[model samples]
Target: MHYEKEDWNFELVVAGAGVGGISAALAAARLFRRVLLIEAGPEVGGTGVFSSVSLICNFRDSRGRPITSGIHRELFPAAYTHYNEQRVPTYDELALKSTYQQLLEAEPTLTVWTGCTVESADVENGRIQRLHLQGQQAGTVAAEVFLDATADGNLSAMAGMQYEIGREGDGKLQSATATFRVSGFDLLKLENPDIQTWPAIHSLRLELLPYYQALKDEGKTANPRQSITCFPYPDGKALLFNSTSVLGVDPTRPDSVSRGMEEGTRQANELFGAICGHPAFRQARLDYIAPRLGVREGRRITGEYILTAEDCLNTRHFGDMIAACAYSLDIHSPDGGATRLESIPGDGYYHIPYRSLIPVGCSNLLLASRCISGTHEAHSSYRIMASVSAIGEAAGVAASLAVIQRKKDVREVRPAHIRYVLQLRGQFTEGEVERIPLPASPQQEPPVSVEPNFKSNHD
Candidate 1:
C-alpha cells in the first residue's frame, strides 16, 4: 500500500517536467526551498521537446507589451527584447531544451528525478502528505507542499481530485497531433529565403496545398485538416510540421493514445510523400516523428475558481491576479475542421486568478499547468506555453510562501503576499498588496543524494 524511502523529504515537490514543472522548480529553488522535481520521461522537456511544438504563442498585449513575464522571458529571451507584434512567434525545441538544462543545473536547491512518475498520492484531510513514485525507479517522497504540473492532471487525478475532461457535453476533445520534422529544402526555389516570417510562411503554405490536396483526392492520406501548417526551425534549415491530427485521442487512456499514434504516424508519412512533389520540398527529407502525441486538451482540475470563456472574451482582471494570458482562444477543431480564434478584448489580455491554481479540497497542493481549472473554451487560450510558465511560477511562489509562513491551509497564505514575491521577481501583476514583514534570504539547502539511476550528467 505504501512504497518510498523513509527519510526523503522536501519543502516542495513538483510533478512532471514540462515547461510548467520546470518553471515551478526554478522559481521555488531560487527562493531556497528544498524542492524535488519528478519527471516521467528520460528527457526534461515535455511536449515542447518531445512533440517538437515549434511555435511560441502570443504572450503580449496588443501594443506588444509582455503580459506573461518572469521565467517565460528566461526561456524565450527573444520575447523579452526585440518582440515584434507582427512577426510569427516560434522557437526551436533543441535550443529550449539546452536552456532548461543549463538553468536547472544552476539551481542548487532543486533536485531532479527524471524517468519517474507520480504513481500514487497519500491524501489526508484534503492535504497531500506523500507521493509514491515509480517507473525507472520506485520510492516515496514527502513534502510540505505539492504542485501538479502534469499537463493531463495525472497527479491530481491520482490524488482523487475531481476534474472535467474535454467538451462540456459530448466529451470530445480537440484532436491530437503527431508533429514531424523535415529539412534540406532548396531555399532558392522560394521567393523569400527567410520562410520564418509570417508572410513568407503563408506564401509557402499556399504553394504546397495543391500537392497535398491531390494526395487526399487520391486517397493516399487520412489527415482530416486542410492545408499544411508548419514553422521554420530556429536555424532555418528544417520545418516542424504541426499537422497529422487524430481525433478522440485521450491521454488518460493509454490504448487511445497508442491507436492515435498509429493513425497519426500514418497521416504524417502520407502527407510527407504528398508534399515531396512541391518545388521547395523536392530535395527535402523526412527527419522524424515526435516521440509523443501533442494532446490539445486534458483533465481540467476542479479548483476554487472555474474560469469561463466569457472571462477570456471580456478580458476580466482578478483582484488576486497571479498571471496573465494574451493568447487568442485558438481551439483546433475536434472534428478536424477549421480552428476557432477569438482575440481578447481591449488590452488584448486577461488575468489568471490565484484561486484558479488552488484546487478545491486540497490544502497544500497547487496546479501549475494547462490542467488548472477552466472551461474547455477558456482553457484553450491560456494552455499555451507562455501562460503555463507564468502559472507555474506563481504556484511555486505560493507553495514556498505557505511553507515560510507556517500556514496550516494553503488558502491561509495571502494572495497579496504571493503577489509581492511575484512582483519582486519581475512578473506582471496588478493586485494591491498589504506590506507584510518578509523573512531574510534563505540559505541554500544542502544537496541530497538520490538513487544512482536518477542522476543525470548535469546533476
Candidate 2:
C-alpha cells in the first residue's frame, strides 16, 4: 500500500482516542494548547462504544460521595443526576459517541485523526522527539509532550519503555467478552416489571439461568461463565449482556484478539439463543454483537511508582496525589471460572499519585490509561472508565503545565498545580493545592444538553 507523507507539529499529541485520550486532549485544548489525537480505528469512542460495555461502573465512595468528576461526569451526566444505588447505572453507546464528537469538535485547538496509528517513535536520551505515523494517514509528527492513552501502552511500547503485562505468577490476563444488545422482551412477563432496579435485574438473570444451564448440560455452548450477567439500558427497553468470557486473549497479539472475537461472538449467539427460551424473552431480538471484543487488561508501563493491591485495599494516600479511584478490585478469572471482587476498605477510594503517570526514566512521556504503572491486582480496580478518565485529565493538565512553565522534564511539573487546575475544573481533589497563575483564564466547560430520545428511569 502506498502512503502519503506529511509533517505536523503540536504542543501535545495523544495516542488513542478512547476515554483516556479524549479526556487528555480536551483538557489540554481547553487550556489553549494545540493538540492532536490519533486513533487506530476508523472512528473515536474506543471500547466503551465499539465493545458496547453499557454499565458506567461505580465512581462513588462507600459514603456515596463521587470521587470521579470532570471529564467523566461530562461524558455520563445521567449517572450523576439520576444516581440511585438500587438501579444499575448505564449509558447508551451511540449517545456517548455523539457526546465525544461534539466535545472534541467544540475545541478549537484540538485536531482528531482517525484510522491512524503511531508506527514508530524517535527517542533522544529519555524523551520522545518525534513519531512516525501509518494507516489511513501517514506522516512525521513532533510534539512537546506525549500522552500514551493507547489503553494497552502501545505508544509507550513503541518508545522503548519497559512495561509488564497480565498477572505476575503466570502472565495470565482477564477473560475477554463479546457483549450484545437485545430488545422487544416482554417486561410484564418477568417476575418484576422494573428491570432498572438491581433486585429486578438480578431476578431476571436468575429467571433466565435455567435455559443457559440446560444449554451447558446439552453441550451446545462453550461459554464458561456460570451465570447470566447483563445490565439494563438507560431507556429500560433494551438489555446489554456483558457475559461470555473468552480466555487466553492478549492485546499484543493480533491473531489472538481476532480469534477471541470470533469465539466470543459464538458464545454471545449461543447465550442469546438460550435466553430466548425464557417466557419474557420469547420474542426478544438480538440487536447485534459488539463490533470489538472487550479486552479488559493490557500492558502496564513501568512508572516511578507501581501501585500495588496492598495500597488499594488499605486506601493508601500519597503526597503527590493527582487522582482517586472508588471502584472495587474486579478481576475476571483467567481460567474462565468465578470473578473476584474486593471493595476498598476505608474511605472506599485510594489516591493515584502523579508519579504513577510518569514513566520511569522518561522525561516527556506520561501514561494516560489503564497502562499506568500498577500491579496486576491493582490494575483490575482503576482500569474502569471513571478512574482512567481522571488519570487522563491529570496527565493532560500536567503536560500543558510542562509546556507553559518551560520545564525540560515532566518531573518539574508540580502535582499541586495539577490539583489546583483540576479543582478549578470541578474535579475532586485532595491534599494541598497550590495555585499557579496562567497566561489566560481556563475556559469553562459548556453545558451539554441530554439526549432527547433516551431517559433514565432511576429516581
Candidate 3:
C-alpha cells in the first residue's frame, strides 16, 4: 500500500460528475468557493450523458408553475419556455453535455477531475478529514465540505455513513436499462415530422406497439415494456430509446453491473430488429448504445430527516424547504413488467427540506444527488434528473455557506441561509423560512420524514 500524500485542497470537493454533482460544483464555484468535481467516469455528464436518459421529467407544480428553476433550467432551457403540460417533455443529452462542459470551463474557481474514483476515505469524529482518489489523476482531496453526488451514495458509503439500499420489502432495486439511439426515420409516414409534441409522440408509440408485441409473443426480445418507448432529439433527426430493462442490476456489485450491460445491449438490438419492419423505422438505423447503464435506484443515505412516501403522498410543505419536487411517486416494479405510478395527491408537488440533505452523524458531508435521504418510494419520485439537479445546487450553496460561516459542523449551518442563496439564484421554495442574519451565522432546524420503467421519472 505505497501511496504518497498529495492533497488537492479546496473549500468544497464534490464527488461524481453527474447532473447533481455538476450543479453543486457550479453553485459552489459561482459563490467564489474553491471547488473540485471528481468523477469516476471519463466524461462529466454521468448517467444523463452516458446512459442517454431521453426525457426531462416535469418539474412543475399543479398550477403548471416551474418549481425546480435554478441549475436544472440552466441545463435545459427548453423545459422552462412557454410552459405547456400537454407537450412531451424531452431533452437532448448531447446538448446537455455541451452545456456542462462549457459551464465547467467557464468556472475559473472550479477544477474538474474526471476518471477518478474515491479509493479510500479518512474519517474522524463523523467528518471526512481526508479522501484518497485513484484514477488517471490519483491524489488526496481535502475540503471543509464534501458533497456525495455519486447517485449511488458512493462517497457517503466510503465515509462509513449509514444508508439503505433498494426497497424495504425484498431490498431489490429498480431494473437497469441500456438506452440507444436511432436516426434516419421515415418521418413522412408519421403524424408530423415534429415528433416532440405530445400528440405525435403518443400516436407514434401506439402505432409501433404491435410490432414490439409480436416480438414478445415470438420470444425474440426480453424487454418487459409494453410499448416502443422513445423520445425525439431536439434536432428531430434521431430517437433516444429508454427501453430494455434488466432486473437484478445493483450498482454496488461490479459483477451485477457488468452482466446487466451485456443483457441490456442484447435487448436493445432485439427491440430494434423487432420494430425495423414498421414503416417509420424501415430506413432508420441504430446509431449507438449508451456508454453507461441507467440504474434508477441507488443507496439512500440516512440523513437528519428521512423523507417518506407519506410526505410525497400528502404533498407536505416544510418550513425549511430549499427546493421543491413536483414529480409523482413512480416506482418501477423490481420484479419487472408494468410499473406502479402514484401521483403526488393534491398540489402535485412537495417541498424538499434542507434536513434531507444533511447526513445523519456526518458533520461535513451532504447529499448532492439522487442519493439524498429518502424512502425507496420517495427516492423513486425525486431520482429524476430535474429534482436531482436542484438537490445538487442546494447542497453546493449549503457547503459554501458552511465554509463562509467557518462552521465546524454542516448541521450548524442554517436552512434559511441556504434558501436565501437558492432564492437569489431563482430556485423554488415556499412557506416561512426565517430570514436569518446571513453574511453572518444562521441557525439550524432539525427534522423530516421524507423510476423508471420503461416507468418514466415524471415526479
Q: Against the hidden reference, what TM-scores do the models get?
A: 0.94, 0.95, 0.92
Please provide, for model 2 over 284-362, each residue's C-alpha lDDT reduced to its tens digit, 9 standing for 90 to 100: 9999999999999999999999999999999999999999999889999999889999999889999999999999988
Span of 10 residues, lowest total lDDT, candidate 1: 449-458
- Looking at model 3, residue 246 earns an lDDT score of 92
CA shift at 254, candidate 2, in angstroms? Answer: 0.6
Model 2 poorest 10 in a row by lDDT: 450-459
| Candidate 2 clash pair list | none
Model 3 residue pairs with clashes:
306-450, 307-449, 307-450, 308-450, 327-459, 328-459
Ranked candidates, highest TM-score first:
2, 1, 3
lDDT of 1 by residue, 217-330 (tens): 998888888878989886778889897889999999999999999999999999898889988788899999998889889999999999999999899999888999998998
Per-residue lDDT of model 3, residues 3-87, tens digit only: 2657668889999999999999999887778888999988899999999998888788777888899989889888798557667
What C-alpha lDDT does candidate 3 achieve relative to the native structure? 0.85
Best-matching candidate per lDDT: 2
TM-score comparison, 2 vs 3, better candidate: 2
lDDT of each: 0.87, 0.92, 0.85
* Residue 446, candidate 1: alpha-carbon lDDT: 25
